[model samples]
Target: MDPALSLDSRVATLSLAGMALAWSVGLTILSIAATGAWEPRVWAVALLATATIVVARETAPLRAPFTAQAHLVVHVLACTAYLLYTNGSEGSAASRWLPWIPIALSLLIVAMCRYRPPREILGAGLLSTSAIALATMPLVAAPMPLHGAPGGALVLTAVLPVMTASVAAACYSRILVANSERWKAQAGYSSAALEPALLSDIERVMYRERVNALSGEAFPFLRRVLDADSISAADRDTARDIAARIRSAMVHEVDRTWLQAAVDSGPTGVHAPVVDDPDACAPMMSGTQRAALRTLISSLGASPRLDRFTISIRATDGTCRGEVWARFRAPYRPPRRRRNADLAVLRVAFSEVTVSTPADQLIVRFSFDHA
Candidate 1:
């Protein structure tokens, strides 16, 4: 796992800054004891500074982006310089044992994995590895043991970390992309899954409306009856009339489907979605498909220019075809990108789906199987 992810972008942690400083000091000490040379130590300073800068910049949101080629080039040069310094280490295991430059470069690449996509990381890693190897292959001294291979093969050992990091970044990046796309796809369905609450809310409103109707139409008359000083022919006639009207209303409301209730239960009194499913195809659709429609409709509602939308479902042969067509006020309409995504979701949910816009209108036609 990449530990760099844990670092906050707002502030660079003291521990990392301290680690970079210690690295520079350690490499400087090794150069003195091993080669007594100033060249390697100088290169160590450059590499340490470059690596620290990369890490710091990546963590800082307002700083230079990780994709900047300039940073990559500086890092490569520093790595190459360190490789040359390693060559000056004679009669000692300092270069062979520490190999700090390549190690640091590899670690930097790993840290970068948290900041950018895999392809960019792969490119950066590979470029750094190849550049350093090319720069140092001719300048640096080759180890004595080739085992029949060319002397230049030692360059590979110095850069192997970079190569590994490149491949790892590529694989890691692909996973990140795949996961992101999946998240975008599933987000709609998850939001739509809240349809139960919407339906429950609609039911609550319907119950309240029913109660209000009874209170308004019959309750007042019943109160008058309870408080009557004496019964009369007119009272009997009024009670019979109220009884007939309430019975008629109850029967009518009972026969209306839940789909109709949902359709007419728009948030706004005007410009509500119009339904045209004479065959009542909504109740027959799979819950998943129905949820998708609900999500699509809810998303469309966000657009202000939407005058009115109609959900028309018809039975044909053995299948139920549906179309959700919405007309705008005029030239203004929803953006193509957002509309495409909404339609894409319906396309996935339905067996067949098509979308079209014929001047001031957005239409999505689809078909689905029964539950």
Candidate 2:
């Protein structure tokens, strides 16, 4: 979507989906009231509820990679089936409000699109609405010749308003995302500057990032000095400052261990589960422990399905304790075989290893001497 979705943002998404469910339910009740048919109206309510549950799971802090797409499938099935089932011979009169039914269901499609990617929004909306429209077309025109019959062709007409609105709204969102990316790219000094991938997970520090900042200042200062007629006292002071900072930065980099570099920026830029090591415990782990943790962190980070990650290293008594928590973007646990190798590394690397996976969340606790 807009790319910067934190867990807090999911609350807002769930709220909107909840409201859509409420409104959809209201429509079901109204359809029943209008036609006095109990069973079909009941089915409509049930379908909407089922769709709502799927939506909740998808919008949760954790869900499968297919969860978002599952919304499209479940909703299309529920909404289309409800609209088609009701607008038939048995309940033609009751479904007189069928036009509004399609629109209401379509609103659900639009509502859930917030959690989906911008590029896919329009296609999801169009395809879902089209499925509803097509399903109704075959039966709508021939629903036992009831008065003011809701015809097949008329179903498309009924859905047109929502369809148009969804398209416009989806396009607007796409444009907003495109513009946001453009603005970020323009403002940044390099690709790394604009993209979060460039950020190092370890202490949120990167030598390259620091060098970029340093160079930003150093290069400009050098150019100014070269263009000037003569070097002033301040110019000489500025040059001395840059030289001192450069030397200090080099010395600091030289002192850092290999583990620091490994965690700071390795493959996949050691992606994005928030690293919360406030105790500064990583640098204290033994060399082998660091290697094991590094491998596991990298492997987990490499998965596109990664949702949330937290690594906490604490110092207590004579030893240092470490915990790594990871949650994937799947509704259930990913296959064990995929992680079996990384697990083996963990078992071999640490003296005391404990691992548990509850739901999709993985927690691994280990201890190593502070080196």
Give lDDT per model, in order: 0.65, 0.63
> Per-residue lDDT of 302-325 in model 2, one digit per residue for the tens?
877678887777778867787888
TM-score of 2: 0.50
TM values, all candidates: 0.44, 0.50
Q: Which ten residues in a row have the lowest lDDT in candidate 1?
A: 1-10
lDDT of 1: 0.65
127-197: candidate 1 lDDT, tens digit per residue: 77877677555434444432333445557776787789668867866786777678868986886898899
**What TM value does model 1 have?**
0.44
Error of 2 at 19 (Å): 2.9
